[model samples]
Target: MRTTPVERPTVLRRRSYTWFPVVSGAGFYVAAIALPLEHGDGFASAILLTGISYFCWLIGWNSSFRFTRTHVSVTNVLVTTTADWRDVAGVDIEGGLAGLLRDGRSLDSIAFGGSLIGEFTGYRTHRRACRLLRQGWWGAGPGRRGKGPVPVRTSVEWRRALAIATALYVPVVLVQGLGG
Candidate 1:
């Protein structure tokens, strides 16, 4: 038998959404400086607005679904959940793209917009993303490797970027407490 090389993970995200975070972050940063200077809200307000800008940038830039040979990882605003191919029961597209686990847990994906937004737009985007995820799931299923059902092992990790963004607001709170 021939030995094959390991494959790299495939990441899925909306290309059209790439401009939102940058534009919004810049807008918020400008408002942060302008509001405090024009309206005299003090440094606390400016810092709080800057924190919100960082939060938007962090969430928009870091969230996506990554599919590897062994598992599928869903990255949301702060938490990332990775489920093995054998642990995933199926894909749920009713709300958005979600992975239903055999252990009765569901990991929601941020790569697709929610159903509320889809209700106005007709769910075309959600359907297409769901199809891609389902294809990856079947392509990496345990049956293809001749493996039986194994114990469900789902792992979760909180991204440090979120903590950094949140920490931006601490100085605002401290400044406000000092009666600035």
Candidate 2:
């Protein structure tokens, strides 16, 4: 007997939050200019602020790129994509930040649920698969509803990237915090 292949769900096309990049980039630029003027520690401060600002801008740019893609299709076999792809086994949405903290990396598997706020509105995904994809992009995994990964931001690869960024921003943030 011949068997027919199962049809995959139609892929959904969604773009990443556009406002995040714009707002973040603008904020960074302003900080870059304002920091030196207020702090004025010579070229070092200027360079530091500029570098920090550029890094923020790059984050925004990368976010935009990450979200901008043709389409994403979830199939019975596997998730298919023509654009950059990330995947998690499942997803679950529970309490607020408090719950998230308790869940740990397990929550990382699923996309965190929350109300649309500020520049994050555009990033909202109603579909489970889409949410999982976004979480994966953010370095989180997909988890079964009600169940989550071990800890948030536990992805070693993503953690490394974040660590690098944090290391670069530490001085700048400290200076800013110190009223510089």
Q: Give lDDT for model 2.
A: 0.38
**How high a TM-score does candidate 2 get?**
0.31
Error of 2 at 74 (Å): 18
lDDT of 1 by residue, 42-85 (tens): 67577877877886765676677878877888777666767777
Q: Write the per-residue lDDT of candidate 2 for residues 1-180, one digit (tens) a residue.
A: 999776443332222433555476567655654554354464466456556655544443322112222222221111111222232233343331111222343222111234446125543353444464455444433333344433212112344445655755665566565664
User: Taking the candidates one at a time, how many backbone clashes does each contain?
Assistant: 0, 18
Q: Each prediction's Cα lDDT score?
A: 0.68, 0.38
